[model samples]
Target: MQNDYMIVKEGGHSIALENGVFYNPKMKGLRDISVAFLKAAGAGGTTLLDSTSATGIRGIRYSDSGVAGLTFLDISEKASENTKRNVKRNNLEGISRVFNKSIQEFAHTREKFDIIDLDPFGSPMPYMNDIMKLSKGGTIMMVTATDTAVLCGAHPKACIKSYDSRPLHNELCKEVGIRILMGYAIRIAAKFNFGVDVLMVLSDMHYMRIFYRIRAGAENAVASMKEGGFGTYCNSCGSFGYSKGIAPVFQQACSNCGKRLEAFGPLYLGRLYDKRITGKILENLEDGNARKIIEVINDELDIPFFYNIPKITKLRRVGSASPAGIMSALGNAGHRCSPTQFSHSSIKTAAGIKAVEKALRSAKDFRLRAR
Candidate 1:
């Protein structure tokens, strides 16, 4: 309404998306989470770069959240103009700079930002190297990848080509995709002598986003690289496990079902969240959807991956069991368990597949007796 392209309001601000300028309303929840994360991470008085700014919504919201300085970049001249207009509309012009250039061009400058966000249309891989040039010690990088198919095994060749890792195309693929993305980031950052410490991760609809802090040191980079490894999964029995290291000898067959095992990775085998930061994010969050997702992620176990309850039950020919009931069964048996944000029907636990199968059997028995 204001700029002839129709004004839309989100996150307490009005933004107009010019033709050819990308703005997704569905990502508002993710944006809300980003705002909460920035506030929780002490964004006040820090410089932020919206590396792929389109409609300038992200940068505007960040500025409103107390970011001291802001730089918006977009390759499309129209997109750049749109961002500048939005910045002016939001009264952020004084503290904001809009550049009609690609991140690769912007990297030519020696300026480094305290926070950098890369939310491109598809994969962020094409821009990662230049992003590293803009990062320094204690830099917080927020990356979003919508090429879920490539990272989730729908296109194994593409995944291998892009991430240099294999992916699983199963119920666990989403988490695998996140790990693959993280592993790729770790490798790329290490090349520049930067270590990555995952602060938070989310596998939401059609995309996966990661927040990580950069530590500057060759030793830290080496330590971070040690977290990369392969994940071995059994298609026959659905049992999976991972080993820490770039290369570790894995059994050729499923230890439980004796079927040939398939491996995916060179993926990250480290904790996915910083519990302290997650708690702080929860405290600052106000959006209902964002809060709900963050709550599940905050409580999620730091386990490598999760098991889809429905998949396990179907494989075992048992009646479908509720995730809560399964968690209860595992807890009663003295195993730590939690529902995963990755999938509503999945649970993460240190208990082996055999224990989960046992819990499924008990749930089926209980249901029959009740009936």
Candidate 2:
């Protein structure tokens, strides 16, 4: 109706997806989360750069949420035109500027932003260096990568080439993928002498998103690098462990089943979520789906990797066990545990595999007795 393409509504805003422009309807939840995060971080009166603004929905919503100044950038001219239209339709033209140029080009300008959102079509690896050039102290960077296959270890060689880290091709792949991303970004930022404070991370659907704040200083960069390490997995027993440092002496065999352990990393081994920032986002959040995801993320244990209950149950041949029941059993044993947002059938807990297996057996037995 507005242009050559159809008009669609998302996050309560109508956007025109012009022909040849890229816009994904499935990313609405992520856009909603972005708006909430901006509001929570007091992004009002600050400038924002939507580096891959397709239809400009994200930047427009951010403007509505009180972001004072906005710059929408896209490589396609059609995308830039569509964003311009959406800005006007939303009455945000007064505060928004649209540019048809690559982010690398824009980075050459003296303009810096308080927030930089990079939601590219695939890996954000190419733009990480330029992105750091547009950041100042305390700048918030929101990055999204949809190359799930590469990062999740379906293409191990590709991950190594792109992220400079190895990935696990198993039940723990999603979490490992996220850590690899964090590690990659931290390393890139460190090159610019900017350290990252991870605010939150999400591995939803087919993509992974991370929100982090950039802090300036060589000491801070070194501190962030200290969080980089390697992870060892026991494919035989579904057990995994991580050690902080570039080269950690890993146990040769699985501690649970005595099978050989495989190493995967040069990945991040730090807290994935900063509870304070997460709490702020929750306080400002209103979307149901975003709220549910954030609540789970808020409660997720700060452990490195999670266990897939289905995989564990099948491996141990202990019959089926419920995730809630397993959590209850672990809690009863004084071990802290919580469900991870990465997978419904998985959980993050400090309890070792033996303890987890014992809890699973007990829970299974209890279920059989009740039945």
Candidate 3:
């Protein structure tokens, strides 16, 4: 009866979402990425703990994909039973175990996991410390945050309260959300005397997923905190800059227009992606959409914020310009530019707002001359 209600196939595993168990068909791409990342990370024969497994689809897929040991933990009884059923359905019992216990409790147990994945319904902040306590040096911790509204600065109070970091909602909201999550992770891990080595940062649909490897040390944590930076955004000029440190020395005026600027940070100013790991993940991708997603992230410039071409154009009262044309102009001007996978109308470039506006104006003049 449970199997007859609702069933979905993902990563070659059949998962049943009957009896009111939670399962989102939309997360298949996420599962695909997880599988690829795990494979790329050489997760074979490694122990994995899905601390907040919903229907156990992710952990089941991992176990089936050759993770040597798999454990599924969910506070909900229905989810636990569903996990057990799904594990049995996939014949993954040999390499998998289901626990109807809280992740908090599991964190205090003697069990150790090489990979600890925390994918919750919203912010993962509440469980960050517990997960860190359970993780050993060299452990890989995967975290997902779905509170985009908060992380993107739509709810600034909540963002600051939950993440202990400021967020910006603009052309760079996605990147800001990604970094806020990372910066929060770095700060929390540091509390446990752990340093985080980011392996990947992914933005998809309505959530941000981050992968980090934890290293044990007080000095490393201190160094990481010092390396993080805050974003200074000027709403009036569409210009921004990054300053490294936990507390930003706010700039009162926009460097380009002399208009006042707003600061958003103590967020992650470090690189969002590790090129080598991303390349390996790309090689391991079997799904077309997943491959496309990684390709976009792979091509994104390792800069602070991306410019929304249309937004900037509207602000400057300029005619519409091609993303490719703008990028080419900026490239010709000796500034690195690339179209971001985050938004079709956005471009990641080292060029300042004034420089970009100049590029757009130049493009417009060239067009008028051609006509």
How many steric clashes between backbone atoms does each model show? 2, 0, 0
| Candidate whose lDDT is highest | 1
- Residue pairs with colliding backbones in model 2 are none
Query: 244-307, model 1: which lDDT tens digit per residue?
Result: 9866877888888888899999999899999888899988788588899999988999889888
Sort by TM-score, best first: what order? 1, 2, 3
Candidate 2 per-residue lDDT over residues 93-190, each given as its tens digit: 88889999999998899588999999998999999999899999899999999999999999999999999999999988888999999999999999
Residue 247 alpha-carbon offset, candidate 2, angstroms: 2.9
> Model 2 — which ten-residue stretch has the worst lDDT?
362-371
Clash pairs, candidate 3, are none
Candidate 3 regions with alpha-carbon error over 4 angstroms:
2-4, 366-371
TM-score of each: 0.96, 0.95, 0.94
Which of the two candidates, 2 or 3, achieves a greater TM-score against the reference? Answer: 2
Q: Give me the runs in candidate 2 sitting further than 4 Å from their true place.
A: 1-3, 366-371
List the global CA lDDT of all models: 0.90, 0.88, 0.83
Local distance difference test, candidate 2: 0.88
Candidate 3 per-residue lDDT over residues 79-149, each given as its tens digit: 89888888899998888889999988888885768999999988898998888878878899889998889
Residue 249 miss distance in model 3 (angstroms) = 2.5
User: So what's the TM-score on candidate 2?
Assistant: 0.95
